[model samples]
Every structure is written in structure tokens, then in C-alpha cells.
Target: MSGRKFAMKKTKSRRKKWASSQLFYEYSTFFRKNADNVIFQVTSDQLPTLNRIGLDDLFMSKGHIREPHWHPNAAELDYVVTGEVVIGMVDPIRHHLLQFHVTPSQVVFIPINWWHWITAVSDDVHVVQVFSSAKRQIIEGSNVLRKTPPKVFQQSYDVNAKQFASLVSPIKETVVIGPPDRYALTNLSDEHPESVPRVVNHTPPGSPNLFFDLKRNLAVRRDHSYLYEVTSTQIPMMNVLSLGDLYLTMGHVREPHWHPNADELDYVISGEVTVSILDPNTLAVCNYRLKPGQVTLIPKGWLHWIIPYTEDAHMLVYFNDGKIESVEGSDILRLTPADVFQRAYDIHAREFTREISSITGTLMIGPPDRPRR
Candidate 1:
């Protein structure tokens, strides 16, 4: 049975339908109407299968900052889509500060429970932060400091209660994103000149900027189809997710494959494509026809494939792991003994051998045949 029908039959009117629409938040409009810097999230609450993966869209204008925050339940993997930003984080375990100047195509990872914040460097900045959970868990710095009571801070730091109270008075509310006012004295650049981010590579010895430039890290292709990935192999600091940008020409396919340990979420960036995912658990199949801005989540260990519906389609895929481990469908089908196929399906041995003999290697992306009209 198809995944859609199975979901309905199993629930039997107890639950509403599983989400079918692609997650397409109008980020530009959301940010413009909101008072502060914008953040839109998509999680299991929005789509059930999204329980294993979540995404947050962040947008900020010049001088604005995303307040320092930490996720207790998920690690954050941020990808810069446009403009520039400086990310600063406090490593509680290491007892040090880590910062990075991130630009388009660059990525950064914040380990779980680490306090981190981002400030836009350009006129406008757009970032996509992916989390390894259905819902993002966050604790803002302002809330932590403000709610602790001035007396507690005074005792802990051996400071005067009156002085500490005055110091923390500005933290009136949880500033999800700041500055409290356009001309506020608490602006990051004005008050924290020493922490200003420089463009130069300032990767500390142990904590490096997990940045990967796609222009430099090219994945060779047989035809026009190509795939470029950033995993732990490329950046040791990456601990949460592996990112990939894939391009496929019309009439080609990103061959069937399954990740051994990661769930894959894809954001279609250009053109159109059709994706098929087969669930091994229930032996059910689901298909999604996607266009730009649409996203699809393939559960972990599910067999899946992608075929382009237009010329030069592009997709950004995120895996919930630092390294990608995949088992290609071609490898499974071609490696089995030829007689196994004949015995299982009652196929003639000669025909089975001939069919299996032609597959030379694991084809990651396509046989390059034209699609039927």
C-alpha cells in the first residue's frame, strides 16, 4: 500500500491526515511584519515525520543580532544562504569563546547546550539553521541572567547587589533578537568593541569554523549531474549534520540509495523533481513532486531516489549526522548472486545473468537516459 493510504487506514479516524503540503514559510513577509529579527521553524508539530529533523529560517537586518541562546535538546547546523554574519558562542566545557565570520555557502555548528548568537554583518542576512529534532529547544541568555535575581548574581560573583541589579536592569524581557532600540547604547558593536568579528580566518586550535566552500570542493560527475557534500571528512568540527548541494539535469536520476544512520531532508532550490521513498518498516511507498522552496523528509534507513522533472534542478540536502554513510541500490541488486534472482522470481538463469552483468559500478547519479515524454 502507498504511504498515504496506509497512514489513513492505520489511524482509522482517530488522527487527522498526515501532512502532504510542503513546508514553505513566507520568511520574507514573516520577518518584515515582526518587530524583532525573524525566526520561523518547521518541526514535527507541523509535519509528523519531521520528528527526526527540524529547520529554522533566520533573517536579520544590519545592526540586529539574534540573542545568545542554547538548545538543550538539539545541535544546531547553520548554513548561510546570503549576506554575511558573525557567530559567537561560549563553550561551557572548554571554558573558551568560539567565533566565526560566516558568508554565503559557509556553515557552522553549535554543539548542544552551548550558548551562541549571531549578528548580521551586511545590510541583510539570511540563514537556515537545521536541528536534529522535531522542535527546536531554546533558552535565551537574557532570560537566564534576568531571572537569576540580582542577589544570586551578587553572591556568586562577589559583587554588590545594587551594582548587579543596575547592570541587569536592561534585561527587562527575553530579547529573542536585539537591539532593544535602534539607537540603544547596548548595541553589540558599540558596547563590545573588543569582540568585533574580523574577516580573517581565526579558527582556534581545537574549534575550527566548520565552513565548506562549494566552489572549491567539487564532486566530479560523469555527465552534467553533480553532488557536493560537507561532512566530518571535510570539517572535523561538524558534529550534527552533513550538508550537500546536488544538481541533476532533466532525464537523469540521483540513483536509489539509503543512509545507514541518518535521515535526509531536502530543500528544492531550483527547477522541479520527483522523489520516491520506500519505507522498509511497513513496505509502503510515498512520492513527492517538488519544486523550488518545497522540502521533503525521508525517514532514516528508508530507500529513496530523486529524478529531475526539469533541466538543471538543484537541491540542498541535509543529513542528521556529521558523516554520510549510504548503501546504494545498485550495489545491492548487482552484487547478489545471479542465481538468487532466478530462484526468487523464477527467472531464467541466462537472462538473469545478462541483466546483472552489465552494471559496472555503483551509479550515484544517473544512467543519463532520456525520460519518456
Candidate 2:
């Protein structure tokens, strides 16, 4: 359970299926130590979000060093996305350092409170690490950090602070977070041997398991709201939505109606749900008991409802379409039909057109010109 005392408040319209208004960070945990955790890429259903989540063509740096730290709350899991990493953890009770220089061509797991460190070998290490702490969670408690005075931690061990400093990096390294500088750690790699040859982090699923968890991509961002804390998003200039936060929630009764400008892409995050869609031409209702991974497309301009089966049924939804984004949702729900949305917002159709294209945004020129499948 998240030890965070903060509550996941209902900040927006309760009528909506998703609660996506203010929360920022999906979650955070210690990275840097487990190189294998950095590289694993899995299907979207495995993610807590119901929408599309992707990481394409990212190369890990060789000098890359993870901070030595542990989190008070939230457990951590890491998957080796690409390359190999030298991992070491302090297992005080076992009376030996619990360290593994691993090469999981696919994935690796890191238990909570495992104060650890990771570094790239020959290739840039790619990893996928997940956290369940309150947004903005950082490395705290029982840590042998880069900033720990070498003199203080030394004498007991043969390594002194200066030599220890050489072992830990100060570029990407941080007392907490080092400034984002690309540094080369040839010195460290010489002492710590590299791992075995491996495949690129992207390995297709063996049996296509729909239930693997990809919660490691989550991070905590204190600057933003809790929901959005540490969470990052991309909005393309063409109005094409690349990644969106989508997930499902279920109850026995028909859900309240809500809409946002962001196009919602949905699937069963879990469980079964009956959905009702209302457009000008049709008011159609479909009930489905979606399992672990199922996709349900929700077109724009259609009012919809979800009737959940299990008391805790869930679904994944891409609630935001680039054209009709969060601002659109806020405008639609907060404003009246009589208000001129463009004038009140001080934005003209041309302004919007310049920012987004008619293709992706589906400009209100007349009838929508969306291509049919």
C-alpha cells in the first residue's frame, strides 16, 4: 500500500468514467542500479493505464549511474530493456551485499527497500522501472548514496571517499538527482566487469501474456498535481495523440455521462463492463465483460455509459484525443451551450487551426471528415 497520507481526491466531474483532471505522477521508484529494469517493453494492457503507452528507439548511456537509494513507501520492479547493468544491493541481514550483475533479455524485478545501484556496461542500458509510491516519491531511508561522505562510509571498507567518489559518478549522479549531463564512466566500468551479450531490450512476448505489469514507467512529480505527478505526455503538432492516460473503473450500475475533447481509446484494464453510446443517429448500448486485455473504441461526439459487472470491474481508456484535449473537457462540462466557446476562451478558429491540423483535430468546418475503417 502507498504509505503516502495524501488522498486520491475526486477533483473533477464525478460523472466522468476516468478521473484525469489534476493528478500528474502516475508513481516513482529508485532507478540506476538495475540496468535490466531499464529496457523491458511490454503490451499496453500490462500497464495500469488503459490507453497507449510506448517507448521507441531509446538508447541507454554507458556512463549512466543510478543513485544508491531506497524508498520508504512503494515497492520497485525493474526489467532489463536492453544491454546489461552491474547491480548491487545491501542485504544487511544476510551479512553480504545482495548484488547481481544481471542480463534478463526481457525483464527483472526489484523488491522494495533494496538499496541498490546500477551502471551500463558496453551498450547503453535500457530499463523499465515501476513504482507505487505517492507522486514525487524520492530515494529515502537506508541508502549509501553518491553524496554520502566517502570518508564517513570508508575505513570500515578499504575504499576511501575519493576512491568511493570514483566508484560513483557525479555527472548523472546526484545527491538526489544529478544535473542531466551525458557523462562517460570508463573508470568505473574498468573495475566492474560487463555482462554477457544480449538482444535489444524489445523482445516479443513468448505466449503474448496479457497480464504482465508495466508499472515501472511511473514517476513522481511534485510540481504537478498528484494525478499527473511525474507523468509525462506527448502532444504532436498534427493533432495526433501519441500517448494518453487511459484506465477503467467498474460499478454494477450504469455510469454517469461525461465527455472530454481528448479522444478516449479504451480496453479492458480488467473485468467486464456494459457500455452505452449515444450519437445523434443512434443511442446504442453494448454490454461486454472484458477480461485482462480488450480494446473498446469510443468515437467523438458520442455520449457514452459503462455498466460494470463485477463490483470492481475496470477498463483502460485514452481519455484525451489531441484535438479535443483536457481543456475541451473542462470547457464542455464547465460552460453552457449558449456560450461561444471560442470567444470566451479568447481563441479563434484560426488560432486553433494553426496549432492543430484539420485532419487530427477534426476541425468543425462542417461534418467530420474522419476516414472510416
Candidate 3:
């Protein structure tokens, strides 16, 4: 059902909260609204996450084109949902040209900071572009043509006007998103790639939401192509962590806990979700009710929980730091000695339940790499 619209019941009062604003909030799709096309900027709880940037889908006629442009830090990941596209890019070194009859499952990877151009080869071509940096860091760029005339850019880039221009026409060019690529990887703490926890990436397509039961250890793709993993590759970053856009997903509920290691960021892509986070410093509570484009950030070591507010909603999740680990939260509470959580939550032993026995005594723990995703 490519490009088919599915019925999604809108909630009357979608405004709901998980805990308190001390830690969570929601924003709508307005972040990228412009006269041109639609682009949704959603992420949770990070300085860079809330900052919006340009990432959008462009629809072109038989010969429409997105003129040549360049950014210092932005790299585009384009996937053809329908029709064919001709893409060309060049940096200081070499030029690359690829003419592809891309379909639903095909993707074209474009590196960062390369001057690039695209022309639609289909009657109506649609494509998705993901920025290497967050939306915030890619808004202001020198539209190469602005330096001179349209023809100058074409000539400077060695693009043939008569032949190429005839084949590539201008579609729609509008500006509606922000700042630039300002953030840098200041502190990527030391860690071995071998420490990444096993993850099962699954989601059924034809829906905006995706679910991966990390606690229960499950995933449902809904028919959409859910990439489980890419292995044995010699690339620097080969896992989902390297995806250009944030990982968009949703689930029933995430147990109350926190990652002592990394910060977790999320935006309510659609539907409603409540996230409760504990403040390790203040010992108080911070709750958030996130909606479309609204972000919920879970700082490291802050105990947290998440759940669907209505029938079901999708929240965009990404490790702002770009490091991920599959911590077995359920097993921690169930199997770990009472003293551990007792010290963390400052609760009495009487508060513990028999369910803890079922949690701690399970025989199903092992390397989830094979069955994960």
C-alpha cells in the first residue's frame, strides 16, 4: 500500500502528561512549516533535539529538479519511495553520478557537505532526505547559486544547461527551517562496540507507529521493512545508530528505570505518551506529556517510564549522544538483589513483591544478538 492513506482516529484532548514539566514537554509539526512542503522535526530532551533543521520530502513532476546546493555539515540520505531519480554530487576531490530507478525499498546514501543536485525521472517522484546533523544545524547554508546567477552555478559545477537542464527541471524550492550545523561531538566517551546490547528491530508498515518490546524482548514491523541489522561490514558505524534521521517507534510501556550511561531523547511522533522521570539530584519527579514534534528527554541515571496515552501513538527516539545499549531493565529489578533497587529508590524491603521472584529466577537470558532484530 505505497502512498495509501490509512485511517487514524485523532484524539479530542491529546494533551496529557506523564509526570511534570520539570523534565518533559511536547511540540507540534509546526517546527518545519513553510509555504513549500511538509517536514516534521521531532526529538526529545536535548539541546540539539529541540532545535529544528530541514528534512523533508519533495514531489516533482516528470522533469522537476532540486537545484545544486551545499552545506558545511549536512549530508542527505535519500530513499526513493516511487519513480526514478538522477543524483549528482561533488566535493573537493571527485564527482559521483548515479542514475537509479529507485523503488520503495531502495535507498541512496549521500555524504555530508557535498554539493549535490537531483532530478525526478518519474511522472511524480517522491523522496525522503535525512540530514547528517540535527535539523538545527542545517538551516542556513550558502545556496551556491546565490553567489552568482543560476547559470553561473550550473557552469561552475560543470552542469550542461541545454542537455541536463532539459532533463532536470526545477520543482519547488522554499525555506522554512533553521540555524546551522553548530553542535560538535565534544565528548563521545570511551566504549567498545562490543558492549552494544542485543536489539530486535521490528515494525509493521502501513502505520506511523513501530514497537520493539525491549523489556519483553519483542518487535513487530507491521509490514514496513524493519531492518534487523547489517553485519560483517567494515564501515565505521554500520548499525541503526548511524541512520540519518532519528529512530521513530512506539510501544505499550517502558519500565521505570534509567541508563546510568547515556541520555535518551524522544519526540511524540504521533498519538500521546506519558513519561515519568526521577531527578537523581533533586529527588523530586518530572513528568511529560509528549505529542507530535514535542520532545521528552531522559537524562542519564534518571529513572524513567513510558506508555501509550491513547489507542497507540508513535514517539521518535534517538540517543542524542548516538550511543545505544540494550539494558535488560526487567531483569535488573527482578533478579538483582533487593539492596540494589532499595538503594536506588530508597524503598523498604516490605515494598518488594513476589513478582520479583519470577523476574530474578528466569532461565532465558543470553546474547540477544542472533534473535535480536
Candidate 4:
């Protein structure tokens, strides 16, 4: 009886299969940690919808720092949600430093294995970091220092063993996020004017900051939908990934399309959307109705479309590859050999040609002359 009870309890503790009913997640309620700063994260372990990607939201107080760290398995795309922050990254392969004074609505990408850190420049700074993988293995600077053999450190820079041990031995615990030893609240009224929070507007030379506003002059802006995409054309130095923000009005749809070069991860920021994706190989379709704080992942070369469920739907799309090449459904249908399609459908060639001729260009966002059944 006791053995049977223990086995039943173990089975009950096992994780359930990923289900469509579990597609929606409020990442704010995910795991969070506070040690001078607050960091919230959602991973595949927490929400299977993030099986291929993960996200972190850092809330940092003034003078706090998200410690220098590197992910062994993922690159990072960071967007400043509010206030200001400074990001410093070291290029792993090239051995060069990239620094940016990032502000609201700005973005930055840190390649995998690149050491990077963020510092809060305002009293309340919030940043969202997107990872390319579901589980990011972080190697924090403090952990690295603590794990290094004393003899290796003594031989590395000619530091004596006693001093090296003294420096690292007292660090009893890791500080994932912290302020400098002397960090204090700045009061402009009682201190020098320079003590007040100031904007960080510099993009150091050679660093080529990949910061762009989503609402800036867009690549495509229509009456019902608009998109702002960050690609090599906009920021030359970046090649790790491309970021895009898309907005659609009520009743509007982001037409069926497939990206040839990249898989897409979509996060709904506001409003609701019904997303449909079809896999060409198996002809399998996955459809979901996602609301604010929900996300969907579409594999590369899968046909997909998004229909707004509310007015002013906004979403962010991230692609692994830096370059973007989308093949729209309209383009494929309009350019298809009319006679071939007509024969396949057993329709008149002229009628088929005339029916699709109206699709002159890509219908990026569409009403389709009528609702698509």
C-alpha cells in the first residue's frame, strides 16, 4: 500500500503535456527575484508556449546594475520599456566593446556568448530582454570569479595567491543584480546638479548602436496597419536578428504569409488576435486566439495569418535571422500560371486569370474585398 501510494504521488507530480488551453501566460506572474533590483522571467519550463524562446523583464532602481553575464546558448534582444539604461557588450569573436546609451522605445541585440551588462540611468528603468532559446544558460561574472582556481588567477595576471583568495573568498554569495558599493539615492535639491538623472544619448563610435524607435518613420504604413522593422538596411552592424512591431486596426488582418529565411515569434502587446499557421509538410494547422500578454511561435516556411479581435492590436515579431524575406499568399496566387491553376481547379483559364489579376502587389494587410471564410 505504501509503495503504491508513493508511485501515485510521483506520477501526480509529473508535468502535464503542453496544451492549447495553456497557450496563454501572464509573464508578470512568472518567477521573479529581487536583490537590489527585480527581474522577472518566463521560460519554456514555466510556459511551454515559450518552447523556443524566453523573455525577461528587469526593473532596476537608480544606480542598480544587472550584472555582467553571458548566455551560452542564446542571443539577446533588449528593448527599453521605460526610463533609460546603459548597455555595454563585448563582442566574443572580434574582441571589441559595444556600448550604447539606450532610451525608451530603443532596441539592442547582444550576440550569444557576448558578455553584457545593463545599468539603470533613471529612478525607474524597465527593460525587456528576449532570448533566442527556451532555456538560457547564464554564466554570471560573479560566478566565474568565484569558480576560478586560485592558482590560475595567481598565474594569470601575476597576482599573489593570498590577495586573490582574499578578494574572492569573502564573496560568500553571488550578486545577480546590485548597485555599486557606494550607490545611494540622488537628491538634486541637496546635491550637485550633475547628480540628477540625465539622458544617455550617445552611440559610441564603431559600436553602431542598433537603437531605433518603433514609431519612427516606418518602412510601410497603411491606413489600418503599419510596421517598423529593424534590419541591416536600418542598422548596418547588426546581423544576429531582426525585430519588428506591427499594429492592426479592428477587422483588419495581416494576410497569409511565410518567411523563407526565419522563424517568427510573436508577442501580443495589446488587444486580441486569432492566429493560424499551416505546416506545408504535414498540412497540419495550428490556430489560436491570443490576447494581450500571449505569444505564438511560427516555424520558418509555415503559412500563417493574423486577424485582429479588437481595435488597435499591437504585436512585436522577432526573427532569428537578420534579413527578412516574406512570400505573401496573394503574390503566389496572383503570379501562379493561370492555365495550370485553372486546370487544377477545373475552371476557365480566363476567369482564373481575371480573378487574380486584381492582386497587383503584396496585400500585406488586407480586408480581401470581403471577409475570408
Among these predicted structures, which one has the highest TM-score? 1
Model 2 ranges with Cα > 4 A deviation:
1-59, 140-373
Error of 1 at 352 (Å): 4.7
Candidate 4: tens digits of C-alpha lDDT, residues 46-165: 766454467775677776678888999987888875678888887655566666778866788787788998878776676767887877889888888878887898888899988888
The 10 consecutive residues of candidate 2 with the worst lDDT sum are 1-10
lDDT of 2 by residue, 278-371 (tens): 4334333433333433344454445555555554453334333324333222233334332354667865655454433323431211112444
On the 0 to 100 scale, the lDDT of residue 268 in model 4 is 66
Clashes of 4: 0
Q: Write the per-residue lDDT of candidate 3 for residues 1-373, one digit (tens) a residue.
A: 1221111112332333343333443332432322222233332222333322234444444434455666565545555545666655543343333233344334444545556666554544555454444452442223322333457646678876565544323322332321112312122112323221222222223321111112121232322212121111212222222221222234335555555555566544446667676766666666666655455566656677666566545443443322344455666666677777678888665457443444433212221212322
Each model's lDDT = 0.72, 0.38, 0.42, 0.69
Error in Å for residue 86 of model 4: 1.5
lDDT-superior candidate, 2 or 4: 4
Candidate that beats the other on lDDT, 3 or 4, i.e. the better one: 4
Better of 1 and 2 by lDDT: 1
C-alpha root-mean-square deviation, each candidate: 7.0, 18.7, 13.5, 8.1
TM-score of each: 0.79, 0.34, 0.52, 0.75
- The lowest-lDDT stretch of 10 consecutive residues in candidate 4 is 6-15
State model 1's lDDT: 0.72
lDDT of 4 at 274: 80
Q: Which residue pairs clash within candidate 4?
A: none
